[model samples]
Target: MRVETIFEMTSPYRDSFRIKGFRFGNGEKTLAIAGPMRGDEIQQQYICSQIVRRLTMAEQHGRISEGKSILVIPSCNPFSMNVSRRFWAMDNTDINRMFPGYSQGETTQRIAAAIFSALEGFEYGIQLASYYVPGDFVPHVRMITTGYETLDTAKLFGMKFVSLCKPRPFDTALLNYNWQIWNTKAFSVYAGCTSRIDSTAASETVDAIMRMMQAAKILTKTVTLSPAYEPAVVDESELLHVKASHAGIFYRLKSPGSSIESGDVLAQIIDPYNGQCLSEVKSPADGIVFFAHNQPLVFENGLIFMIRGM
Candidate 1:
């Protein structure tokens, strides 16, 4: 295993910030896995760390395929991670929203440019991604419906679900979208949690990545984990959104991965000052809960749940 600083910047008030990459094997740039562009993505970073550790062992054991290489960047914004801030500490800009960035642009844009330059030519790219909202997902692999995306390849991860979302205008600047536009097959792996680590989900994510590598012939041998399961493929239209009508303290009655029927009580919004139940959020469709808001508070019209319709 070889470790290198892919990007570095000399900070005026603190130590130099460096984005490190761990390389395994030698030859073709077969795969690149990135993690934690945002500081609060603890689970994303943790999953990437596990991938690096496993790859290191595989490299040492000569299990990595000959003439193929894998790179893992466990954290992209270490400065923000150090301070526990979600975006750029100084400007509050998101590194993820600055993909295929300009070198002369703002801090996050420059950082994105540097990282993308180093990762551009890989055959496949995987990102440990989190939802925009603070919530728990049902652990799945997601891909943009860019022409370059491969749904078959995404299913190789063997997660519970494979979601394909049509790219919106704002998605054009995201790493996965940019990677696809650059002719790289990019995928985003979403574990169950973001800021908090879910050990079972993390393990499942690591296993899924390993399974994908093995399936791609990038890994000559497989890790001794359980066999990968078949995943259900769903498009964005199949997901049903549940929104909060009133702002208040939020409490969830149903968790992600739970089965739900129409009109089932999914959560409750409580009046913060009056200690009264403000609203009872109910499921609008018979489906499986794909995501659920886990945070303590909710705003009016906030997306609190996503149900994958049966």
Candidate 2:
């Protein structure tokens, strides 16, 4: 049980903020958890911090057990966290994009190097994440590769579904790159989107983390997760891009987080000057609606919704 703070130059605008790591218990199976490498996904950092706070309380109250060590880096990139941005100010690069970081590379690369070096020989690494891009609040778990092992591991998180996503092998993504080098068991939990705090997504993420802790025997309390809610699990192959056909004022007839059927009137694009409808977008599949553009004005070829079939 130890706590360490690493301080170094992270960006040009300001000195590096402290990267805090907490080790709990004295178990042989060590776990490393990280969150919010991107500045935009600051909510994820908050989520990790909550977990650390709980674990710290448990340790102080003599609730933690023997033979298990857990290391949590609440916020990996503090510079971005301070400004609520997603990239380091120095090079404007996504920190998660720099993995297996180099000592002489870039700012983000150096932070990754320090974190990855600390993660060596851990039993499992869980990368915390949220949809930092323009997307809907969909809580999901992802793995870097396929095979039943990783799939099962993702499923154990007790989320609605696990997405089988593959990162480019040599892309230097923090999770994928570090996984390759350390070769320790790893998975990532993604919830909500950038700059928005979806309470449902946050709760689901907390539930997933508790489930993992129970599976690892780090926490003795028996956890009963809600029966998995059936979700529209669509592969990257099944994703239908609903693009706006005409430029006009867009009105969504339906909201995200709701089920829709094929041919349903999802939205209508109308001419601003005239009351006449310019174009109507209909659902092509029976699935859940996500990422509905609520704005009245829309551009041609703008993404309206992403429907994942049931």
Candidate 3:
């Protein structure tokens, strides 16, 4: 295992910021696994750390393929992570939204450029990603439908769901999208929770990555844990969004992975002042809950739940 500072910048008010990467084996840049680009992605960071630890052991045991290399970057924005902020601390910009960035642009752009310079040219890229909204997701592997994306390769992760998303306007700036455009097979793995760690989901995520490596012949050793089930392929368009109709304190009656029927009460928006039920958020379709808002307070029209129709 070799550790290196992949990107660094001197800070005026604090210690220099550095993005560290752990490299295993020595040959083709076969895989690159990156972690949180934002501060609040605790689960993403934790999953990446586990990957690095496991890869380190694999490297010592001569398990990594002889001619294939793997790089694991556990965190990209430690400054924000230190203070528990979500975005870049200096300007509140998202590092993830500055991919394939300009070196001469803003701080996040420069940071993105430096990170991308070290991460590019790999055969496969995996990001421990989180949803933009504060919520819990059903563990899944997501890919942008950029034509360059390989769904079969993504399914090698052995996640329960493989989601193919149509690229939105803002998605062009994301790391996964840029990696695909750069000819790397990129996948985003969401491991249930974001700001908090879920050990079971994290373990599942680590196993999924190991499964992928074994399937790709990047790891010569066998993984004892097999995939629980074949992943269900779903398009992004198939997800149903349940929105809050009134601003209030939100309480969820169903969690991610819960089966639901049409008109089932998924959650309730309570009037914070009067304690009255402002609205009962109901499921619009017979399906499974893909995501449920985890935070307490919600605004009018806020996304309360995401259901995957059966």
271: Cα error in model 3, Å:
2.1
Candidate 2 lDDT over 1-310, as tens digits, reads 5788853654445665668787888866567888778777766876787788777776776656577788888778877767766677657887677777786886677778787777767877888865433655456766655332255556667776566554555444656446645667777777655566766677778778767777667776654655555433346445666989999988888776678899998899999899799988999889877556655688999988877777
TM-score of 3: 0.97
TM-score of each: 0.96, 0.85, 0.97
- Steric overlap count per candidate: 0, 5, 0
Model 2, stretches more than 4 Å misplaced?
10-15, 60-65, 146-149, 169-172, 223-234, 248-256, 270-277, 290-298
Report residue 140 deviation for candidate 3 (angstroms).
Answer: 0.7
Rank order (by lDDT, best first): 1, 3, 2
- In angstroms, what RMSD does candidate 2 have relative to the true structure? 3.1
lDDT of each: 0.92, 0.71, 0.92
lDDT of 3 by residue, 51-138 (tens): 8888888888889998888888899999999998999998999999999988999999999998898889999999988888788999
Off by over 4 Å in 1: none
Residue 282 lDDT in model 3? Answer: 92
